[model samples]
Target: MQPRLNFYKASQEAYNAVKNLENYVQGCGLEPRHIHLIKLRASIINHCAYCIDMHVKESRHDGLSEQWINLMSAWEESPIYDDKERALLTWVDAVTRVADTHVPDSAYETLKAHFTEEDMVKITVAIGVINIWNRLCVGFRAMHPIDQPAKAA
Candidate 1:
């Protein structure tokens, strides 16, 4: 699909603000894998193919297992995730769909079992950042780069 516009070039200051948030989220002490999972799952829910493709590549580069990546959309039924991971995923769903879920107490209670107050804030920030990115990418029709076959040596 053709892009609606080059968001970055169209508004450098705005893009830079988003980049700043990205930097903060990266340093917020959440595990790298958790960050990737949150980003990927939220992108899937938001139906942002560009963000989904980007996060999948990043996650793979960080050595996340293919099985885990494959299970992101149906994480509840996957055996690959632990209790903490499950809780985080649950939280992501609640917050990402906050308009509908209203981030119910049950979701908060489950998250509290696995994360401290500070960690909860960090996770929420991570979720918020990803949601913002998903909206921008999808709205702008950002396209993920097409994969090319490896060249013979």
Candidate 2:
């Protein structure tokens, strides 16, 4: 698909505001692993192919296994993730679908079981950032790179 426009060039100040939030998420002490997982899961739910592609590559570079990353699409049925990872995945799902789910209390309980209050807040912020990215990319039809031809891994 083609891009509608360059979101970064449209307004540098607006981009920087969101970028600063993203920077905070990066240093917020949430595990890089969990952060990557949250990103991929949210991108999937939002159906933002640009973000899904970008995050899959980034997650791999950060040392997540291809098997694990691939299974995120089917996380509910996958047995690969541990309890802590499972909790964050659940939180990602609920928050990403907040309009429909109302950010359910059960999801919060699951997350609290594994993470501290600070980490829960950080995770929510991380989820919110990715959703913002998904809206921007999908709304603009932002295209993923074509550095290599697509094929099965």
Cα-based lDDT at residue 108, candidate 1:
100
Superposition error at 9 for model 1 (Å): 1.1
State which candidate has the highest lDDT: 1
The candidate scoring highest on TM-score is 1
Tell me the tens digit of each residue's lDDT in model 1 across 1-153.
799998999999999999999999999899999999899999999999999999999999999999999899999998899999999999999999999999999999999999999999999999999998999899999999989989999
TM-score, candidate 1, is 0.95
TM-scores of the models, in the order given: 0.95, 0.95
Instruction: Give per-residue CA lDDT, model 2, range 1-153, as digits (tens).
Output: 678999999988888999999999999888899989999999999999999999999999988999999999999899999999999999999999988999888999999999999889889999999999999999989898767767898
